[model samples]
Target: MGRKHTPFTSLSRRKRRAKTLHIKNLIYRERDRLGGIFFDECDQVAALASGRWTWSDIIFLSQDPAIFWNAEIITANVAFADAVEDIAFNEAFSKLNAAETQQEMHLDFTPDVSSNGKRWLRKPALKYPQFDGLTFNDFIDKRALEIARDNPPAIYCGYRILPGYASGIGLQIVVEADRLNRAVIETAIADFRARGERNWISDVPARVCYSDKTICTPLKIKE
Candidate 1:
């Protein structure tokens, strides 16, 4: 499985294009890299913020084992105030840390990602990746650690690991170890149907077995 790059109309600047996907400030117990939190509120920056956050602030969460994080991605309007945790899952990542683990994931806040490692968001990205497509009641049975053996698209976080060496603690994307193939196809269809974008798909080349069908994958992350 290898990548077949999808060429697009080159952009003059790579700014975050306007997104129709709503956002929210996911909220959950900061469980030492276990999962995410309740990222939905009215007074977002002021409600669940530990320090100062902004309407455009893109926060990062480091889950221990760097994988198997059970978090929620709430889709809100523009800011945390309008963000809504539309989906939640406890699964593996797809690309970033293809084959790695950490016991204690950490969380940091920074404005610049000068050193860590990352690229811009490319084509054929996942549209609405869910845990089990359970719709709040779908309990995950990742009892099987499966992942897509394909390399998905990625995006830069605009900041890097403050400590420098992000071995197991770097940026990543989460992909289910069990349903990667379908995931790939889903991505293509979504992009075309919703956004009128056509991109390529592949099984990928960066996946490593984490054991028992478990794949520590991410959503097109980098080191």
Candidate 2:
């Protein structure tokens, strides 16, 4: 009698290992990306203030999806930090029973613009957004809890195979896929070029990175 064949193949094992490694790298890569963007933007903003770079340059750089999303997270963090201090001061005032003056603290954690991609912090809002009757820290703490739940340590690696194309226009696409087909890739590229053509009057090149083997390239797919 023929020996029983195992279900798991050697190829499957290699793919599994590759995916695991990819995810681990993504965790580190994402952190570095966020940090790099923050520091880089800090420098850029300083340059703009100092007249070393014009507003046009800063605006151009902000067009990149990666930079834009990172900036949003950084902005949210800064806003949250500033709010904490004010909250603490107000809490101290409230504790002093001298006067029952109602104090109002408003926090708008929403981003000015959507990054069209996943960032370290997305959809940041106060857990108790309304701040009905809670202390400053209490409201802030609740928001922190919500943020922790929404933005976990894990990284999503579903869209790495696509290009890094970006248009100065608001429209953008950033996604990851485990396996991409020819039609999907072509469609994405076509859409990307179309957006560039529509918004970017000048000829600007689009970028593509096929980090995963499962992603089909135009050449390979045609073959």
Candidate 3:
């Protein structure tokens, strides 16, 4: 008989765990220096060559919109955990609170393949003059719709294993927005588990937020 499977031993889960660990380790290294937000706008190649910057230094740029327009925007399917995201935000908030002038801080951090995580899938850079009058959520909604239209429905799983620290698992069901109702998500999860990948399924459907006020999840739909 084939070997019985467990969560940790599963190839996919192990890979996800490795990614989560890497991101956590990066943040932990900068834990002390994380009390402030930082921004950078200089010659990218030259700055990286100077060895004065690192990817962790500017990871927060993922949250900013203006930088997307003025500079190159890189998107990564980062193994996101609440703790990791929270620590980064908390550090930045601390700096913002202590400053007499309320503005974002600037910094230079370079990333190389050495620091690359499984989530960082590089693609062609996208340049936008501005978001126009659309809010960030609006932009994301449009993009999500475009993606749904371009691709067929697919299910992807994500998880974070922190060993003795913390662990999380999530399942993303990608389908048309109209087709993403709670019933559909539940059925997808059921079907997924019926296929013997039940060990990788989260107790609740992964909360996929299309906008601040709108989110889809197994617990309850938020509007």
TM-score per model over all chains: 0.13, 0.19, 0.21
* Number of the top-ranking candidate, with TM-score as the measure: 3
Give the runs in model 1 whose Cα sits over 4 Å from its true position: 1-27, 30-157, 164-223
Tell me each candidate's RMSD, in Å, in order. Answer: 24.7, 22.0, 22.5
Residue 41, candidate 3: alpha-carbon lDDT: 28
Write down the lDDT that model 2 would get: 0.31
lDDT of 2 at 151: 41
Lowest lDDT sum, 10 consecutive residues, model 1, at: 15-24
Error of 3 at 115 (Å): 46
Q: Judged by TM-score relative to the true structure, which candidate is superior, 1 or 3?
A: 3
The TM-score of predicted model 1 comes to 0.13
Q: How many residue pairs clash in each candidate?
A: 53, 6, 5
The residue-by-residue lDDT of candidate 3 on 53-168, one tens digit each, is 21111222112121110111111112122223344344334433333113224332334456574344433323222434443334444545444345322323422222221222
Candidate 3 off by > 4 Å: 1-165, 168-170, 175-182, 198-213, 216-223
Q: Scored by CA lDDT, what does every candidate get?
A: 0.24, 0.31, 0.31
- Judge candidate 2 at residue 115 and give its lDDT: 63
Model 1 agreement with the true structure over 1-223: per-residue lDDT tens digits: 8765332112112311111011112323322232232121223323224222212212222222121111222111111111111111233332114222221132323443565535333222222233333311222223221221232222111112222221111211222222223233233223323432222222443232322111122222121
What is the lDDT ranking, best to worst?
Answer: 3, 2, 1
